[model samples]
Target: MSSSSSAMLHTSPLRRYALLASNPPASTSYSTRAMAIELATLPLPASADASKFADFGREVKGVNLGSLTEEQLKEIQELLYKHDVLLFRDADVTPEQQFALTKAFDPTSAVYGHGNNKTGKTTLSILHPDLKTIPRVPQVQLIGNGMVYNHEGLAEAKLKHPHHKTFHKTHISDEDEEKGATRFYRWHIDAALYDLSPPKVTTLYGLSVPRGGKQVCRYDDGTGDELEVPLGTTAFVSGRTMFEILPPELKSLAVRSKVRYAPHPYVWMAPAHAKSTGLGIENEGLEMSFDDLPPWEQSKVKTFPILWKNPVTGGLHFQVHPCGVSELIVDPLPADAKKTGNELYPDGAHIKDLGAVRDILYKMQRPAIAPNLVYPHDWHEKDMVLFHNRGVLHTVVGAFKEDQVRAFHQCNLAASDDPIGPSEEDIKKWA
Candidate 1:
């Protein structure tokens, strides 16, 4: 980034975060709610009733990726876009094989959730864990204590961000809660920062999961655990509709407040120049502030961008996640707003009432329609589960935690923005 752009994005503490707290909604050809409903409520044909959720992929065969041509690889990318999620059943592939295969879909592949989610396919595969790197970010997210929001990815606040080079959680035996206790997430999305939606397909390979997995234990007696989600089955979540019912507090906050946080494509689209800069921030440094950007460049950023387009229809979807940096963290607000001429956000008194706002936002945790959809993949060896990242909010049940150790070599389907979000873009970069 230019010294100017860096300064422009620079948001030091003291600069109230409410400035960028909320970005206006994006203009999309398709309705986010409608798409959420369609995907979440799609009816399977009578044949589908007898057929398993992923029998389609099993029926359609593909040449072993190890034998595909570069052109064929590109074709597969397009194919993945079409199918959204595909499963590769019972094929002998190693983590290295999985990584290579995942990379085939996107050049920017990254292994995410270093320790929170299992990755190595088998007990032996655990030894072959993928590489880890500290995310360089300007903003810091600290929620309560165990729940911190940082670019290093989600973790219990007290835990040293598992990906941390030196920090590793002690895997306490179940009998010992205090000792081997690693943290658990309260069913949340991956990125909550910006308004950018996720991609169409994400694949998870179940290397191992507990036999008495938590995922499959939901009550069926009058309770709403309809889908008997199984391990090895790649489950999908609906990002936009997870909680379409915006809480009264949030609405009051939204309608009552004139001040708004514009979604910067930096969450998705950063300057092309940054990419060549070695994740950009590293060479130039993350201290780069948004104030450094020319007013004209600032004009180029999008408050909200349609992140997911239908692989087949090319339609857009809404994005809603508990993304941290992208949202205004009332406390420890960044200083970029005051230091600069409100490039990050316009000044407003609305922030004083954030606590009230939190109450309203808390209400959104429920569903206007469905709480959230989990399209479990039952991650068998060759199975691949894909879904629009923007379409849903997904979580790994970690059910395979039983004697059946489950995992596969994995990585974030990387993009070129955000030092910290959905990708290098959605993660932790600033405009």
Candidate 2:
């Protein structure tokens, strides 16, 4: 929002949540006067792995997400399905209260999962040069990085801010990126996979916060991994701790698989690239040729399900987004189950080989993006955050300074249902 941040939001006043009149500081915080909401977990990542994520994320103090109530929006959707990320530092939110707290976590949703000007008319989408539409809350998206003046209605924009040397595939030398070195610009899970649906939550907010100096993220995929982050940080990673640290035959190939995706999938992988550990595409066939994308519809493609469950921690998350996949299917092993060795496709298959579907989703989502199982987010000016778009797998890490302007205000919605897979006793207890 920038009309001098909407004129400093009328000289400050939206803080709310008083009545703590004493006694509330120990056992890692939490407060509730019928949801006056106070919470407090988010801190780990001094190279995290603190005994497996130490309860994902939380922070949220004195809640004024612009006056919530519906029992504080059902305890902020049960604290975002039990803390999959929620921070809110100094927030005063508004793009209509961050699209009504992201449509109150799917109250039958309302647009923008990639279709309100659809990444600005899909210029071969890879989110066409990173989002901007917020002309009075077009499901809130003003994103960050460069020029911005009247904002919210855009009378001058320019933004950008996504930089793994233009979608990665080996990059990290401009004297190791001017010595502050970075990477991780696209891990994903905001999902516009196809005919809209996957957005169970995602709020962001941080208006213009770009103070610099922390950079190092470089998992150049050779695994000398790196992580010191926080320059333009936003990292995160834990689809249920990437399905509880896999290896039960990749958690029974992630609850018996499903993926598919691809049609228009950001214009069929906007000419490929990723995977210097941004986790997915590096096949080099440089995509875009299902008869030249864009008019898709084998019944609007999609497919989904490599795990997902967790409606408040039934816990089975491994959610897949590996560069808009394109077929994996699987489904076999349950007869008496216990096969133990040589179990990969157990009997069923499908796959459609794009380097064997990015080598089985990079051997089951690369050890949950290790750098001690990441968290990264360090933004400040009125922060906000939220996340748990069906569990986690974020990205967009460091590098900014073409005069570093970085404003923020995101918000997610396109999900009037779809993402509840896995039960049949969670596929016979993980296939």
Candidate 3:
């Protein structure tokens, strides 16, 4: 974080010693990294339809979303609201198209997300499976962003993966260290650190997801099933497609292993963070155990997980990533209540006992469902799809990584005629 930004944030009301002694609101807002981890399937919107567009998987390359006619643009926007995501394969896009796509979704969003220093417009990453961008600097590419995984300009506490790669944990990497072809970023939400509404829809056009069989996974909640939608398919998520209602079994399995018992120092950061941001985000989220929660807390746990609705269409979407959630304290149930456990997906995920808890667990799993409707297209290299930012969630099966030479571009801009960012009122309603 810049000294100026830090000064602004800290100097704000949350810093008073008394407020700091207890819990504060700014901590609720600014405490964690970019994305909240230890996740449950976040929910989708209310108006979901899976089969609206038969041309969804069609692929086309080398063009700008800017070229579409005014009528076509309106149709695309409406389609996005109806289907969540629109897929155009083999898309060849220009910087202008990149900017236009941003405008289509959230005109208020920056044309160049977080600039080169933070979010990569044509960014780069090096996973062994795919090569996505030119020169291996991936901000140059855009992929299925059901959930925004990029942070804002630059914030010290932006929530991100423990490591850019699967196995490493040093929070600080200076620019000199990351100047090479391999650029790594954690899975997180766009504009999550500050009080910014997450970009409703993010796009990732795969130049090549490769046939090597290294399938990167995305969490599909409805059936608690893993969906391997092909590269050509743009996973549109909106109302009714929320991940909040995950499968009963899958929700428990994600954290059931040793991950459940591990004690992380970051857990200690909660009191400090929560004390500052009355937003109530506990820094010690992962440490709380299902068995240790208080009665009211347990009830909240028993209730459905947090889900988001697009303020624009009143549509729902599943926006949770497995690694981005926290555990809530739960209270033990009465003996009789415990006897009536859930009877679905009775896999290893559910033990012999804890039946009631199991029921609550089941409720936490958002059903893995597709957009009520989608604009299906054939996979081709000359096309690009655009949609409403506050409309749906999007995802894909291929890694589309920079190593594979996969290329795509994106730029965010305000859609309003007056040209102002998304209003804070809308962000509150949407996020």
Candidate 4:
């Protein structure tokens, strides 16, 4: 693992935390609600080989997710902000209830992150083939593989789990695939990356999970790095860790850089193919032409910071969607900067060449996705997972057979506000 300086770790006064349930429902006030439930830290997934990510998720038990009160919702939102992921086992949450829990994080926001239920209609979108929205609660989408019948008002629907074979430039042979081999199906933060702000958090409830032997996820980048992952798993890596693991020069560049996304991003990248590792697109010049995209406006295009500040922890997280990014605009070193020598961008530079931009980001971000740092959640029936969208990068791992039916409800709202970037102190300290 790469070493991080003491500056990256936020120092705080320690406080006691425990597993507790409110016997006589706590008051609605923030102070009283704080006592309602304390988030209980849990062990990482059984397959995880390291303890570095123990703070990534907290397990909540004995709570009825379908009927959470305002106070409970606020506490969960706070916990989600601090831990970045929460696990609820054996949950019986409905589509409406799942949407409610997601919206509780951003009260005024009501629409789904991807054009408010416009995925299918926008055939050019990269997300078109992955999600099927629930009819009653448009915010919640029904995802997974195979045919689902009479589910939440939809009479019949065929769901297809995204497979690396379709997106990756070079995939394993069918014989190898049949032998339980797979790849991560695009590492990403769930967002439209256009007009809509990135969602603050996402909730996924597993309805039917296909049970089978573990599969080997091959990076296929010639390093021969591979992971033994559960069938149809979702892999995650912390964005904060992605930022912290960077070398000093890269760290300085990350804090001072901003990423400009392509217009109608998903549609713009529809023709592109991803790398074998699913980190970013291969540079074969297959992206859609700007003129070919649907009617779009310059004002609607997004340009976000390379680093997003965590609201609760005040940590700066490296948050970039590798596939959708078009350019990198970096600021020069501050006049009063403390560090010197071999600086990346001493004078501000705007990188417009797609290849150069992707190469720079790939070198800085790929180390964090090493096997020891990844967390592949093992899904079980009725298991609900909520993750802080801006704080981590995740991907769907492995493919499912057509006959194996798997179903899940997913929800996330386009945030009402844009993510916060680094402060002046952070720039002066790092740059």
Better of 1 and 4 by TM-score: 4
Per-structure clash totals for the candidates: 92, 1, 135, 0
lDDT per model, in order? 0.31, 0.79, 0.32, 0.84
Please write out the lDDT profile of model 1 over residues 363-400, one tens digit for every residue: 34333212133344444444444343434445433222
Model 4, runs deviating above 4 Å: 1-42, 45-51
**TM-scores of the models, in the order given:** 0.43, 0.32, 0.42, 0.90
On lDDT, the stronger of 1 and 2 is: 2
Candidate whose TM-score is highest: 4
TM-score, cand. 3: 0.42
Residue-level lDDT tens digits of model 3 in 1-431: 96644553454222221122222223222222222111111122233332433322222222224344344444455555554545554444443334445444543444233333233221221121221122222233343222222222112111121122332222223342232211112222232211223354555444432333322122222233233333324344333333334453332222221111112212222222221101122233333443432222222221112334445355433333222233322222222222225423222332323233323323343233332332222244554555444434333223333233333343333222211222334223222
lDDT (Cα, 0-100) at 250 in candidate 1 = 36
- How would you order the candidates by lDDT, starting with the best? 4, 2, 3, 1
Q: Candidate 2: which stretches are off by over 4 Å?
A: 1-63, 66-70, 73-75, 82-169, 172-183, 186-205, 209-252, 256-274, 280-309, 313-315, 319-383, 405-424
